[model samples]
Each structure stands twice: as structure tokens, then as C-alpha cells.
Target: MARLDRGSVSGAACGPDMPAIEVRSLSFAYPGADAAVLEGLDWSVPQGAFELLVGGTGSGKSTLLSLLKPEIAPAGERTGDARVLGENVADMDVRASAERVGYVFQDPENQIVCETVWHEMAFGLENLGVSRDEMRRRVAETSYFFGLEDWLHRDTDTLSGGRKQLLSLAAVLALRPRVLLLDEPTSQLDPVAEKNFLHALFRVNRELGCTVVVATHQPRPMLEYATRAYRIEGGCICKVADIASLGHREELFSGEVSGWGASRRAKNGVFSSASGQLDSLGPRGGAPGAKKGLKSGKSAEFEVQILSQDDSGVPSRVGGGRILQKMHGGSATTLSEGWFRYDRAAGWVLRGLDVTFSAGAVHAIVGGNGCGKSTMLSVLAKTAKLQRGRMVRGAASAALLPQNPKALLVAETVRGELMEWASTCGYDEDAAQERAAQLGLDGLDARHPYDLSGGQRQLLALAKLLLIGPELLLLDEPTKGLDLANRRIIARALCEHAQAGGTVIMATHDLDFAEQVADDIAMMFDGEIACMEPPTDFFADNVFYRA
Candidate 1:
């Protein structure tokens, strides 16, 4: 039956009082581990309800979600029961289980399998043996719903981080599963894209009666859609009467970091932790070089208000703001572009773009999805040269921290992965261990890189790049998967890098991080730098990227 036609499952899953999912006394631990990551956990989600699950970086949010879906559950010693639709998930028929329970992984990379957007959208339908007519109908409806018609034929590999995330969700939702499990579904999305996705997800729960359980570090975006929330803490789940009522201090940050201009003093690598101590979740704050007050709302009277520079190329208008402002001016052509795109027929991802960054300052590039931020970084890092136009660089030693942290992780153990370049980079075990401690990787040295949490892998990849000690660093969404505390860890690392005379440039949708750490906030649009200013002036005057 068609999902829109059927409305809801109406039977076992949609029964008024039936638990769509139930867990009791469940425990899970990786092989040869000291103790269980989760223990004696009891949780349940009712039919037709929208549930939010919030936790820290490695607090087992992904692990629990994977366990709920039997096929992809991690290898580990397990105990107790995890049931779905009144059937023990481990014993249920694989195909039936997959069709009924749809899972959208935390990382978009984990969910997308096909090369093209259209193929990915129909991949699930084909597996379920849907008729060709039905598959085409579902694909058409979902693409239009997602506003993906413009790029339905586009290659999935070329899509931006936020776009890839949208494709992943659209693909799973095409199948119209009875119960949907999502992990940080909007982590990569920009402000507008995030809002649209949340609206669509809400419809899926309300119109389709699909039970939704989302695990996120930042929960502010979906608070309105959430009916009730449960927090994963200390190996068990605790119900929170009000997700929005909890203050930033107590909510375990509950998914992604909040506070638009929230910041901390980065001094001697001693940035204050909002999450109690180093190894846990906390309110990530601003660095000494971070801008404190970030404003929002669009300005109708918007024009380019570029910061002027003196004859020596130092910024002429450094304010007495709360953070340190670097002086290097237009001479810092952090992003110098002419004209470029992936294909001859495709529109330019970079065209007539020029932005400067100080030699020893941290800069952030903010833009909507597919605004050529990643392409610009790729060109600057010399990973991909611009096809048509000039891109000037510092000729200093450089390294790039990719949006996908897994790209850098190759070895089996965390320590092994970080030390993979010890011989060539002159990095010793002692230095590697110290670097790990600095970034809060203290107890995870022996674990495999893939075995670590999404945020952990993000940090691990960054650690690998920092070990090589490049004079110039290019980061593509460094904080995409981090929790509040780990966000602070990354901020401190970048600030320290800049203070050590290394240049830092990052592309991100995180307004908070851009304000907190970047000396200059540059906004990209239609493959060019529409405007550039210091954090304060940038956030104050921008029309599109104010969030």
C-alpha cells in the first residue's frame, strides 16, 4: 500500500498503547573492554511519538541506536533484550526488520551507498522489491518534498556536506519506514536547511505515524518538534520532563553546542570546560582570540563593509573587543579565486572570489550549502587547483582536516593511527601521547579509530594533522560532529595553533564557532566572497547567514 494512502500502520505498530520500541536491562560492551558502555538500560518509545535522545561525544548514543536496528548492531558482548514491534529485534526477519525500522546514521557517509542522487533515492525501494511504477512515484514525491529535483541527477560525491546529509535522509524516508531512527540528522545542515529538514521530519511523525528517536549533541533546533526527551548518562537513560527547560549547564549539551556568541578564554591551553572536566560533555566557550557578542536578523541596508588595512597591510580598525585581533590585512589572500567548477556544464562553485586571512590568525568561511567553501579550501590547500583564475597561497607548510574524519584514520588503534606518521614527521610516542591528552583522547589510545565515536574520530583526524605541525591548516567543518565540550577542545587547539604562528582557516555552518574563534568571518555566496568582516561586524550585517 502507498504510505500516503495508508496514513499509518494501524495495527501492531500503531496500536494506541503499543510500544514501538522497548529496551530492558540491556548492556553492551566492545570486545576485550574493561566495562560496558551501556548497562541496565531501560527505555521505550510509544507509537506516533517524536522522541529526542541527547548525549555526549562517546556516551554511546550511536551504539544504542545501532542496537535498536539489529542488522548493523556493533560487535560486542550483549545482555538483556531490545525489542521492536513486540518482536525481539535480534530474532526478527532481517528484511522485515529493515523495512519496518529505518535508520539514518549519525554520519551522512555511513548512510549514503550509491553514486548518484537518483540511484540513492531508489536504492532502498529496489531492495524492498517495490514495483518500478511505485519506485518512480516514491522517488518523485520525495525529491520534490526535499527540493532535491534540481540536483536529482547530480553525483552524490560532489554534493556539499549539508547536501549529502539531505540526500541520506531523503533516501531512507523514500521507503516510508514505520519506525525511524536518526542520529544527528541536521548536524551538517545550514540554518535554513536544518529548519526545512526538521519540518519534514515532523511531518513524517505526524502524518505517517512513524516513531522517531533522534540522538543529537545539539537539540535546540528540534526542541519544538520533540514531544518528550530522554538523556543517556552514566550507562542508563533518564527521562527529562522538559528538554527546553533544562539550562545549558545541566542538559549535557543534549546535541551540538548552543549559544550563538558563547565563548571561553583560551590561555595556555586552559580553556574552561562547561562539561565538568576534560573527558566529558560541557558548555564549550570562547577563546581569548574569540569574539563575544554575535548579533542576528537580516539587514535590508546591506553592503560590503570590508575592514580597511594600513600601508603595512595591518588591519586599521582593530576594536577593543574581548578577544585578540590579528593585524595582517588584505595581504592574507586566504581565499583568492578566479573562476572554477567541477564540470564544464555545471555552474561555477568558485567565481571571482577573493578573501584575505592574517598569517597568524584563525579565519572561518561561512556560507549556505554548496556555496564553494569546500572547493575554495581544496584549491588553497593545493589539493585541487583552480581551473580558471588565480589562487595565491602562503607557500608555507600546510595540512587539511577533511570534513570526513574517517579519511585520515587508517590504523587499527587510536594511538596507532595518530602515530602512523611518527617516523616521517619526526613525531615520537611521547609527543603523540601528549598531543592526545591535550585533545581529551586520554583513555581511548588502545581502541580502533573506526570503533571510536563520530566526535572522537573527528578529533583523531585533527590530531593526526596537528602532529605533522603544518604552518598552514585548512579545516573543512572541524566541529561538525563534536559535542559541546569537544567543541571547546577543537577551539582551543585552533587558537593554540594560530598563537604558535600557524594560519588556520575553516569552512563551517556553525555561527557560534565562527564568532568564538575566527578573527575574520568571511561569507561566501554563488562561488564568491560576498562580504568579509571581523566577527562582530560580519554577524551584525550579514543577511543570509545570521544564524
Candidate 2:
């Protein structure tokens, strides 16, 4: 159904007993931009609606959410009025609105302000002047609920990405806001951790009736729970009467609700199944085999290894455990070796390890929350040394795209930056520009690195590394903050690069993304590789193979 226009909505009139949030004709545009992000958008949530907003990236879902809490709205935008809890957002003060609205940013790093989990959780209550004793109680309560009591004192930097996101939530929940806005809160989490977080969210909604609104490209987890599902397009919102009727049942499991060949309506009498769509749900596809023969099972795989760079700058004397696996190609990759711990207090975090990645293939790693997937990726990237057994390999060129690519960008113009990296790679300016265009950065030569969105920044960072032509690329949770169009733009570029015979390794919670683009699949649990196989087999049956 098409959505209403902003001019059609009114602020002075919501019927009595209206939902916690009501938007009518809420239109807005970003600063210095003539185009409006939202036009004639209208949506309303009763006192306790669990609303789920689903759309591709840059579809104006985030922009709509920002309107609910005006403090976060971008500057230089004209907005039709939106009322939250009987108060017009434009008229309300920012701080007071913050206290009443709990918003969790998509990037945990952006929202995290404290050094430790305990302090971070308590910061909100402290600002509200909740007594010290009360703050302590709230902290303890939230920690216990989110399973963070043991790591309460742990440094925020030391926490894994999933854990860091969990901490972000606990901190926001500590504020006990009347309305909760989660912006892709589960993008970094593994399966288990995501389930736990959702359980907590539902509990809060059920018990406290804290009106919940979440914007996400992935909707399976919230399918049965969300009171209403709304789709955003052209900066407008429309009520979706029945999501099941959309004919994308697979979306209820994997988030591949949108994609090429994926959005095909149930037409032409074609039947679909797990392996791939078919005329009939039969075994003809045989669940496409993995690149490295890793099988599937319910439990995750775990392997471990440790090695050090010798005096000759070569990987020498691998001594950790059995985490190393040599694929058909010459390259060797690391899988988790059961959960490893540096101290007794840290306990075991990784479990069974099994992952098989071909040297020249594009593989994606994903799992539920707190599943030690990022830790394994860090090990692969050689960023976090393992105390038990770090996966060590012979000298191989590797480039990693951290969750935030902005951290690595340090150039004035895209052209200058690529030129700098080209010099390092012994390439000339013309060569660098050629590579930049291939990556889809046309006419962006003079653009400041900081001006790019998360996706564009990532592409630029990748361009810099590609100039050197690294043999292996390790991308840690690359699509966390990207919109669908941006995500597709990056994915297509990576696919082209892979076709050119480079090995691409991506760790993400986007399962559908893996299914669509990965040549091989790896699933991590605890600190081990649970399964590694082809996308088809991994999703249908979780299994990892050993070489």
C-alpha cells in the first residue's frame, strides 16, 4: 500500500488514547539538500505497539526514526510536526526528550561513552539523578538480565563486538525510557546473543509496555513479535496489512527478503526450497557443496593454532593447536580451537571449531550474538593475538575493513588518498585513478574522505588496500551500518574483485548476504568454527568440515 504524504498529517489532532507516537505528514530533508528524505509520511503506535520498520538502506527508515527524537535529527531540514507521548518533538527540549526516549545507535562505538560496562550502564541513571544506591540496583539488575555481571568491570575496548553492542543496550535500558528505538541493534550479534537480546526486549515491552520501534533490513527475528510491519520507500511509510502475503516466507528465517531473483513473487508456477528456487521442491540442487568440503551439523566447529613471525619474517613453528586448515589451494586459514582463555576468570568463550575457506574464493562468516565470530575474524586478521593458539600462517598480504572504516580514512580527497596508497604500491597516479573508477568512485576524486557515508568510506578504504592488491581481504562485519543500495554497491564491487581471483573473507551477521554472495560459508560459535560449507548446506544443516 502507498503511504500518506506529510501535508496530509496534522499534529493538533490525535484521538484521545493515541499511541505513544503519532506521525502525520512528517516530512524532512537533510541540510543543504533540496530533496526530501520523507514525504507525507504517517505512522502511529498505540501505547504498547512493537513496531518493526523494514526497508533497504537509505530508504528513509532511519530518517523517520530520527524524527521521533528530534535531538538526533540532521540540521537544515524542514519537518512536519511529529508528537511523542503527547508532546510535539520540535517544541520539546532535547535533553528532556533524550530522557524520555531511549535510542540505540546502529554503531555501538558511536553510542558507547564509558570505559567499563558497569560505568556505562550507570551513566544514564546518574544523569537522571537516580540515587547512587538506586543506580547500583539498576546496574546490577540490567547486568544480570543481559548476562554481563561477570564482565561488569571489563574494559569496553576488551569486549568483543557482540558484547560491546550488548553493553550499548544495557546502558540504554538503564535509563528506563518510555519509548525504545533500536536501529539495527542486532547487526553485530550472533544467533544466541541475538535471541537473548530479543527475549529481553520483548520482556521489557510486555512488562513495562515501553513502546518499541526498530528499523532494520532484517526482519525474521521480529516477525512474530512486531505488532505492525511497515515498509519505507521514497521517504514514505505505509501499513503492511499482512507480511506473509508478500510471498517471501524465507524472510522469516534468513533476511534475504530483498535481492535479485529473491524478490520474485510466487509466479509462473515455480516452487522454491532451501537449496535454491526450483520448479519443484526436490533434491536436484543437492545443496551446493562448499569450496573446501566442510560438512554441516547442529554444533559449531572449533580449532586453534598459535605461531610467531620468525627472524626471517616468515611464519615459523606453528605450535598452538589444531586450528589450521589447508584448503585445496596453498593458503591456510584459521578456525577456532574450542573455547580458549588467557585467565581462569575469562573462562572459555569459543567452542568446537570447523571452517574451510578456499584460497581464491569469497567466503562469509556469520552466527548469532556473543558467538565468538568476531574474535575468530580478529585472529584471521592477526589483530588479536591468541594466548592459547593463534592461527598462524605463512606470509600473505591481508587488508582488513574494520567495522568503522572512517577510522582508517586520513586523506583530503579520494583522488589524493588513492594516489598515496598507489605510491606505497609503486603505482603511478593514473593507475590509482583507474582502480578508483573500477570501484565506482567516478568524479569523487576531490571529495573529502570524511564526507562519504559509511558504505562509501568503506569502498574508499577498500580501494586504498586494493591498490596494493593484497592476496587476502578480511572484512569484519562490513555491512553493519549500510543501507541496501550502498550494501549492494559494495557487494557488487567485491564480487567483481573476487572474479579477478582475489580471496575475500567477510565476517557478518547478514546471513542472506552470505547466501547471495559467498562462495563458501563459515559459522562461528563460542570461540570455535561451528561449521564451514557452501551457503546452501550451511543454512539448511549446520556443519563444518576439516581438511
Candidate 3:
């Protein structure tokens, strides 16, 4: 939260109809790059409009967002005129620009600097030299509006991922910036939390008149609230249109089908709600061998069944071999009455959790934030000791990828990092390169690992772990900042791993992804696993846990 010290530019008076942001013939490249990441890009955001920026991984969405602020503008050759609130961003003072243009990073932890929630909210105002009374008043108002009153006195480290992200937004909003720039703010949140956070952003735009520009891979949830939408490709703006004219609003809710007896049809592997009779006896319907009119015990609710077929109307086996082959005979890890906690004074994170992971299978753990999903993964990965439970390990070794992928990144270049892991695992350079290409890191071998985008960094970390050839792979939020295309790549890779007799256990808030790849879905709640069943049964039966 240290204030940047670049010199300031005098504020320019803007008319009511002027755009909040305007860019013309902007081109930028990093210090050592051969070509510009953004080339001849021109864009504008209408005043008070909620703008959504959608693009694939490494598509310059982040680069464009960075150029909007003076303090964080990338170091490189630049040619263009970028203006914010009628003032040229290149000439604006750091402090003044920050006051009118608030930026929130993808990772909430990165933006937070103070220990407690209250202090974090006050940090930005303090940097702006606001009076003590005024700071207190603004902090109180912002916190209350964001619903942080209950946790105001609590330590920030103790809050859940969702709360931490909300706290970051509240802190930025306390400055009362005229425009807010968010980079994948909801990528780490659960479905419910993500929805709530987007609604809060809508309120900020509608009620406070703060123009918003969000760059996200998951744009379906925010489309309804967006006034305009733009798609970036090949370092340029490819499509721009009003949100209402997008003609695919219903498709946005395709992945969120939760109510009992509710049936949904899958389109190109994405799920959406169905209002008519459920199809239970066809290739596009329920489980094979299931009755035509399957219903739940209490009511006529149809049993949740995911149709297994590719887009071409043909049965397709996603995994190499038979699905769920390991569930019958293979067991990688078993936790019996497992219980864990950080300290004796703190409440237990995992309470009597009993679950078994099968080899040659992908298991997904889904739950609300702070419900012990990560803690369970740590226990299974042997990073955390099981205090009061019997544990059985079936695998010889396991590789744990923490939620923050940056933790495992230390090498100067991406290739060096992978090669280091390869050397440890007795792998050759060819094998390393092959794996890197599979994960879409083919041409980034010589680039600095820190310089890659967040999604790229996540993929590199995964590639490093894959080179080790561990018996068990543990991933936490593998798809946090990845676009849909990148997510598909990871999903296919995990499926191939399972086919090769390896165990894969991932804890994610992405329920759509869980349905797409998981053989078994486990729900954790109140420090204990509440249920474990097939993807179809797990999502259809549980109302709240269904994403």
C-alpha cells in the first residue's frame, strides 16, 4: 500500500458526455520482447458504463489494463495517447491518478498490506493524506456497504479467500475513485461469492457513478450487469457491442443448474438449465442403464446424470481407458476420522473427515471459501500432520501445488524452472519441452517466469509439477485465472494423467470444471466432508453446493 511518487499533472475538466477512458493508436512491448504485446489498439469506455473485457490467456487484456494507470504502466517502448478522465495517463501524477483511477489486482492477498480488516481499509485514505475524522468516516461507510462489519476487528490472515477479495475492493473504494479497474477479481471466489461480488460492482457503478472496467475469463456471470462488452484477440480489440445485443445472455447461466428435479442440457460441454421434461434414456440424457423417468426418493426430481458425448453427437471417451476403473480396486489415500487445526485455540479446519481417493481417477473437492478444502488437500498431500485420525497413504509420493502458484516459481526463466524439476525427476530436455508445449507454454521458454501473466504462471507451475511424474497430483484452484481454452487444456491433461494410472485430486470453486473432469465430487462444509458421490448425483442432490 505504499504510495507511488511520480509527478502529477493538472486535472482536466471533462464534459458529462466524455468517455471515462480513451485510448488511440496505443502500442506497447516489454523491455526485451521482439514485438508489441498490444499493437495499434484503440478503445473507449463510456462514462458510468460497466465494461467487460474478455480474452484468452496472454491476450493483452492485462497489458491494456496496466497502461490505464501511470504508477503501474509497463516498462517498454510506448506510442499512443491514453487518457483517463480527460487527463493524459502518461503525464498524470501517480498520486492524483491513483485517486481517480483505483486498481484491484487478481490476487487479493497481493493488494492487502495491513494485518486487520479495519486498517487495510484505511491504508489507501492515509496514503492520500485524508484527515483522521474523514478517513474514519469513509472507512466505516465503505466497510458497512461491503458487509465487512462482522469481521472489521479480525486479522486479515484469518479471513476466507472471498472475504479477503471483498476487503481489497472495499479498501480501493474507500478512496472514492471515479473509475475502478479490476483484473479478474472473482477468479478465486466460489460461485455464490462470485455472484455477490459482481452484484456489488454493479452497485458501485449504478449508485456511486464509478465507471468499471473488468478483465476476466469468466464473463458469463457479469454479462447481465455490463453495459458494454469488448473482446480482445491477437493484441487488438476484435469485437465491441452493447451487453443486451450479445444474444447469449441465457448461455451465461448454462453452468449454474442447482435446484432439485432441475434438468439442464449440455451445449458443447457447457451445462444450462432445461425447463421441459428430462431426457433420461438417450445419448444426450442421464446415465446409461438409468430408467427413462428416473426420480428422487422424496419427489419426482430426476437423478443428476451427465451425458458423456463429444460435440459431434457421438460417444466419446474423454479419458484414455475405461472411466472409473480405479474406483473399484485402486485406492491412493484414505483418511479415517481425520481432524486438524492450526492451533489449539483456533477452531478445527478438518473435523473427522473420512474420504478415499482412488488411483487412475480425478477427484474434485468443492465447497464455499474457508470450508477446509485447501486444508484437506494439504493433509492428503502430507504437508499437514493428521492430529487425531488414522491415515493411509497408497502413493509413493505426491506433488502439492498451492493456491498461490508463485510460491514454487523461483527460476529466472520458465525453461530453467522446468529443467530444474526435470533434472530432479531424471527427465530429459525433450520430455520437458514436450510437456511445456502440451500445457500451452511452448514459446515462453526463455521468458522470465515472473514476467508471464498470472494464468501463464499457473500453467508453468503445473508443467513443472507434471515433469516430476508423481504418483499423486494435488492442485488447489488450478483454473483460478485461466481462460476457458486454457482450462480445457488442463482438463484434458488431467484426464490423460488418470489414464496413465496416476491419482489426481483438485480442490476448486469451479463447479462447471468439476462436472467436466471429476469422476467423484466431494463437498466439504463446517470443517467436515458432508457428502461424496458421482458428479451427477453430487450436483443434482445438493442445492447449495451446486455451483
Give the Cα lDDT of each candidate.
0.74, 0.63, 0.75
Q: What value of lDDT does candidate 1 attain over all alpha carbons?
A: 0.74
CA error at residue 397 for candidate 3, angstroms: 1.0
User: In model 3, which regions exceed 4 Å deviation?
Assistant: 1-10, 242-329, 544-547
For lDDT, the strongest prediction is: 3
Residue 291 C-alpha lDDT in model 1: 24
Model 1: per-residue Cα lDDT at residue 433: 74
**Which ten-residue region of model 3 has the weakest summed lDDT?**
297-306
In model 1, the runs with Cα more than 4 Å from the true position are 1-14, 246-335
Model 2 lDDT per residue over 5-70, tens place:
212222434343766887888777654444676898888888677988877655677667766777
238-261: candidate 1 lDDT, tens digit per residue:
999867764343222234233212
Give the range of the ten consecutive residues with the poorest summed lDDT in model 2. 298-307
Ranking by TM-score: 1, 3, 2
Instruction: Arrange candidates by lDDT, descending.
Output: 3, 1, 2
> Which candidate leads the pack in TM-score?
1
